[model samples]
Target: MRMVAVIAAAALLTASACGSGKNDTPPPATVEVFTWWAEGGEKAGLDALVARFDADCPGQRFENGAVAGGAGVNAKQELTRRMARHDPPDTFQAHAGAELLDYIDAGQVEDLTAYYESWGLRDVLPAGLIDDLTVRGKIYSVPANIHRANVVWTNPAVLAGAGITTPPKDLPAFIDNLAKLKAAGVEAPLALGRDWTQLMLLEAVLITDLGPDNFAGLFTGRTDWRGAPVTKAVNDFTTLLGYGNLDRDTLDWPQAERLLIDGKAGYQLMGDWAAADLEAKNFPGYGWFTFPGNGNTFQWLADSFTLSTGASNITGTECWLKTVSSATGQQLFNEAKGSIPARVDVPSSGFSPYQQSAMTDWKSATQVPSCAHGSGCSQAWQSAVNAALRSYSTSPDPATLQAALAQAATQFVRP
Candidate 1:
C-alpha cells in the first residue's frame, strides 16, 4: 500500500507539471521589415536598429525584406501584392507627407494615434512633425529622421581645381562656379543620376527656390505650374544637368556618387544620405551646402515608416517598431545614416560639421515643407508631374506641359 501511494503521488505531480500554465509553450514574437535600403550606408543604419531590437526584445526576429532602386520600385511592388492578399509586411517606409494616405484609405494601414498617445510620442516630437505624420487627426506613421534633400556634395579638391576657394552663396555665383570648373577641364559639373533619383533632385530645387507656400500650391493645386519662379527653377536644373559628363538617364546613383567621391565631378545635388557614402570611403574634407536657391526660400523634404494594419504585433516587426521610434534607437540609426534623428531632443554633438549645421538650420525653420515627390501628393499626381517635367526639361514645350500639370492636379488618381 505504501509503494502504491508513492507511485500515485508521482503520477499526480507529473500530470500537474505537464498541464501547468508555466510549463506550457510560450508563443514566439515576430515582424517583417520591408524597405529599399539594402546597399551603402543604409545597411549600416539598418544593422544598428536590428542590434537594438535583439538586445531589448528577446524572442522576436526580423525577416529582412529589402529591394533596390531610389524609387523603392521592388519594395513598393511587394507591399502592394501583400496588401492585396491581406498579408502585408509588418512595417514599411514611405515619404512622410501625403504619400501615405493611399494605404490608409485602402484600410491596409493601422491608426497609430493610440500608440502615439500611449507612448507620449506626440508630446515628444515637434509640431511640424506631428502635422506631417498625422492625417485627419490620426497618426499612421513615424519618421525615422529628416534627410535634407537639396544638399550639394563635393570634394574640396574639385572646388580647388576650379580655382574657386569657396562655394557660392547665391544661384548665379553657383552657376558661374560650375562653368569655371567645367572650363578648367573638370569632366562633370555635377554627378546627376538617372531615372527617378534624377527627377528628385530637380524637384527639390524647384520646391526650395519657389518658396514653401508656392511649393505647397503646386501639390495642392492652389497655383498652376509655370510663371517666372517655376520656369527659372526648371531652366537652372536643366542647365546643371547638361554639364554632367554621364548621360542623365543612365548613370546609377552609386556610380554618380563616385564622381564626387573620387573628386572627378565638381558636385552632386543629393540628400544628406550622400554623406554616408562619403564617410564609408574615408573621403576627406567633403563639403555640403544647400543648393543656392537663387535668392529664394529653401523648401526641403522628409521620409518615414508606417506599420501596416496587422503588422504591429508580429514578433520581429513589433520589436523594430519600438526600436526605431525610441530616442536611443533613432540616434544610433541616424548617426550611421548621415542624418539627424527626427526626435527634437536627441543630442546633435555626434554629427559631422555639415550635419551639425544642417540640423541647426532645420530646427530654426518655421515652415519647412516637402518637395513634389515627397509632398503629401499621391504618386499619380507626382507621375503626371514627372512626365510633364521630364518632357519639358528635354523638349522645351512649356504650353503642352503646363496644361498637363493643371489636368493632373484636378483629376482623381486611379491608384
Candidate 2:
C-alpha cells in the first residue's frame, strides 16, 4: 500500500481520505486519526490529546475520522474496507496485544520499534507491558492507556441501604451479597449489558474460580478447555447471570452502568473505563472493589495507536505517535479516559481517587490478559467465544456452554 494507490482508491470511497482536497486551502500538515471513540469520556480524552498535538506541533492539524460504535463495532468494519482498498488513515486505534496480529499479518501496519528506542519509551513504560505490545522482537504501536477488566463498581448508597457492610472478597461471599441485594428488593443486583459485558462478567468469574495460572493458561494453551475447572467456571457464570438485568441484551455498557448509578442495581462488573464516565458525571457515593477472589490479579486491556502502511503524511503521523507516547500526552489523556497511564513514571497526582488506587495495584498485582477486550485471544477466537456465550445467555445451560467453548478452543488454538 502506497500513497498513490491509496489516493486513487479513495476516489471510490469519497469520505475516506485524509487529504480529500474538499477545501481550497489544505493545511500544512494533518494527521488523520481513526478510532471508535465518538462520544463520552473517550472522546474527551481524544480531544485533550489533539489539543496537546496542536499546541506542540504548531503547523500540524488533527483530523478526527472517528465513527460511532461501542467496541469499534462499526469502525472496525469500515477500517477493514479502507485497508482492503489500500486507503488507510495516517494512524488508527487498536488493542495492543494479539488483536494487532491481524493488522501485522496483513502488512497494513508499520514497525514502531525504532521510535520506541529513539523516544526512550523503554525506560518509561513497564517492561512487561512493552513486551506484550511487541511481536517477534519488534513493536508496532504506542499504548495510550491500561484498563483493568476485573473491577466491581458499587453505588455506596445502594450497598449501605442493603445493609452490606463490605464488598465481597470470595465467590461464596459474592453470591451471598447478590442474594442479600435481591432480598432488599434490588431488582437488578448485578447489572450486565449486551454480549461483550456478559463475556466480561464470565471471564471475571473464570479468573476467580480457576486462579491466575489456570486462567492465563486458557490463552497460552497450557490449560485444558474440557477440564473440570472450566466446567465449574461455566456453571458459576450461569449462576451469576441469574442476578443480571432482564433487559441486559438490549442495552450497551453505559446504559447498564445507569442501573447502578440510578440505584436500581447494586453492582456492575466492568473495566476501569467506567470510572472515567462516573468521574465526569461527578457521581457521588461511588466505590470500587476487585472482583471476588481476584484481588491480587489484574485483567488487562490496552488501547493503542498504530501507524498505517500507506500514510500520506509520515512526518505528521510520527508527530502524533510521539505525542501519544509522551508523559504529558499520557497523563492528560488517562486522567480524562479513566485508565492508568502506560508510562509508569507519571505521578499519581494526575489521577482520580479510584484511578490512584488502580495505579498502585498495577505494580503488585499478577496481570492476566483480557479476552473480552482483545488481549487474551485472537479476534477469531473471541468471535467464537462471543457466539457461544450469547447462545448460553438464552439457554442458560452450563454444560452446553462449556462444550461449545472447548470446541472453539480446539478450532482456534494453534500447535
Best lDDT goes to which candidate?
2
The window of 10 residues in a row where model 1 has the poorest summed lDDT is 294-303
Q: Name model 1 segments beyond 4 Å from true.
A: 1-9, 12-27, 294-300, 312-319, 371-373, 389-401, 412-415
In the range 43-96, model 1's lDDT, one tens digit per residue, is 888888788878878877766878776657677777788788988778888777
- State how far residue 386 of model 1 sits from its true place (Å): 3.2
TM-score of each: 0.88, 0.91
Tens-place lDDT per residue, model 2, 262-366, is 999999999988887876677856888999988699889999999999899899989988999899999999888888888778899967888898898887788
Alpha-carbon RMSD of each model:
3.2, 8.8
